[model samples]
Target chain A: DQQVKQNSPSLSVQEGRISILNCDYTNSMFDYFLWYKKYPAEGPTFLISISSIKDKNEDGRFTVFLNKSAKHLSLHIVPSQPGDSAVYFCAASKRNYGQNFVFGPGTRLSVLP
Target chain B: DAGVTQSPTHLIKTRGQQVTLRCSPKSGHDTVSWYQQALGQGPQFIFQYYEEEERQRGNFPDRFSGHQFPNYSSELNVNALLLGDSALYLCASSLGEVNQPQHFGDGTRLSIL
Candidate 1:
């Protein structure tokens, strides 16, 4: 059973537009959430993260919003650039349990110039 | 600073063969984690090593094992490789802090025949 799910398999956005990627999880015990971006032949790069204590976290052009009650999170990239085209993965873990992260199927985002 | 580095960018093996992959963590990082990424899917955690010990592991079987050196580098060993083992193997490193983001390497692509 997949504990984390990214419903959208792919997304396309024009350069300078805003791109939004969504994720959902079934486990409520997950307290830390992270987003990673990956390019072909490269490992996923850590982008942004949000703890359950806060509803949102923003890093430069990337912002992640979490809704605890809904068990959903979204990553927003404003003024998306062509360089932003890549696969984005959402991962979650319980902070206190020292458990490994559970990652969702990634969403491929294509930024068209 | 040099980021996480993995060895043998690609490898090919047959069923029942054994393979070993190596990783050198980012500068000053003390923790290492391993993940497997299948085509069109996000990475799945295999295990983590800290202080030369296996701190946590995912649902992967005994066929997957790892070792961490005193220098903080790590190695992943897979025994009795099957076709299903074909995937991208990723290594991530981080500080032993409570909630630090992980830095990943380019990964080693393993193909099983």
Candidate 2:
């Protein structure tokens, strides 16, 4: 069974707009959530993260929101740039077991110029 | 400083064969984790090594094993490779602390013919 799920397979947004990607998880033990952006032929790059204790965390243009009660989380990138186009993966891990991560299928986000 | 580095960007093996992949963790990182990512799916955790020991493992079978050297580099070995074993193998490294985001390598693509 997939512990984490990213329902949308792809998304498109024009530059300077907000791009939102959503993810859900079934495991309540997960306390830390992270988002990674991957470009073609490269490894996934760490973007932003949110702990279950907080509802939101923002880094520059990237913001991650967590709704523990709903077992859901979302990543928002405001004023999206063309460089933001890539595959975004949502990952989750339990406290103290942070080395083992469960990842979602990923969403391909295209930021149009 | 260099990020995570994986050896043999691509490999091809036939059924019943075995393969070994290597990874050098990012500088100052002491933990290594391996993942298998199949096409159209997210990465699935294989196992993690810290302090030259296997601290945690995923649902993968004994056919998948790993070793972490004192230098904090790691090797992933798969025995009796099957066609199903074909996938992109990713290596990630991080500090051995809780909630640390992992840095990943470009990954080694294994093809089983």
Candidate 3:
């Protein structure tokens, strides 16, 4: 069974617009959530993360929000640029555990000019 | 400083053959984790090594094994490879600190023919 799920296969947004990606998990043990952006033929790059203790974490144009009660989290990018277009993956891991991250299927986001 | 580095960018093997992949962690990093990503899917954890020991492993089969050197580099060995073993193998490195972000390599693409 998949512990994490990203139902959206793809998303498209215009330049300078806002892009939102959502993810859900079934494992309650997960206390740390992360977002990664990947380009074709390259490894996923770490974007932002949020701990279960906080409802939101923001860094520059990127923001991550966690709703532990709903077992859901989302990533938001304001003033999205074409450079932001890529596959976005959501991953989760439990604290003090082995630090093995569980990733979702991913969502392809395209930011148009 | 160099980021996580992986060897043999690509490899091809037949059924029942054995293959080994190598990784060098980022500068000053002491932990390494291995993951497998299939086409159109996110990465799945295989195992993690720290202090020259296997600290944790995922649900992968015994056919998948690994080793960590005193220098903090790592190697992944797969025995009796099957067509299903074809995928992108990613190596991520991080500090031993909990909740630290991991840096990933471009990954080695393995093809089983």
Over 4 Å off, model 3: none
Chain B, TM-score, each prediction?
A: 0.99, 0.99, 0.99
lDDT of each: 0.95, 0.95, 0.96
- Native contacts matched by each model: 0.71, 0.84, 0.80
Candidate number achieving the greatest DockQ relative to the actual structure: 3
* Candidate 1 regions with alpha-carbon error over 4 angstroms: none
- Candidate 1 chain B has its poorest 10 consecutive residues by lDDT at B94-103
TM-score (2 decimals) of chain A in model 3: 0.98
Against the native complex, each candidate's DockQ, computed on alpha carbons, is 0.76, 0.84, 0.87
lDDT of 3: 0.96
Residue B74, model 1: Cα distance from true site in angstroms: 0.5
Instruction: Give the C-alpha miss distance for residue A79 in model 2, angstroms.
Output: 0.6
**Among the candidates, what TM-score does chain A have in each?**
0.98, 0.97, 0.98
Of the two candidates 1 and 2, the one with more favorable DockQ, higher being better, is: 2
lDDT (10s digit) by residue, model 1, range B75-101: 999999999999999999998876788
TM-score of each: 0.98, 0.98, 0.99
lDDT of 2 at B48: 96
As a TM-score, model 3 comes out at 0.99
**Angstrom error at residue A54, model 1:** 0.6
Tens digits of per-residue lDDT for model 3, A1-113: 99999999999999999999999999999998999999998999999988888999999999999999899999999989999999999999999796889999999999999
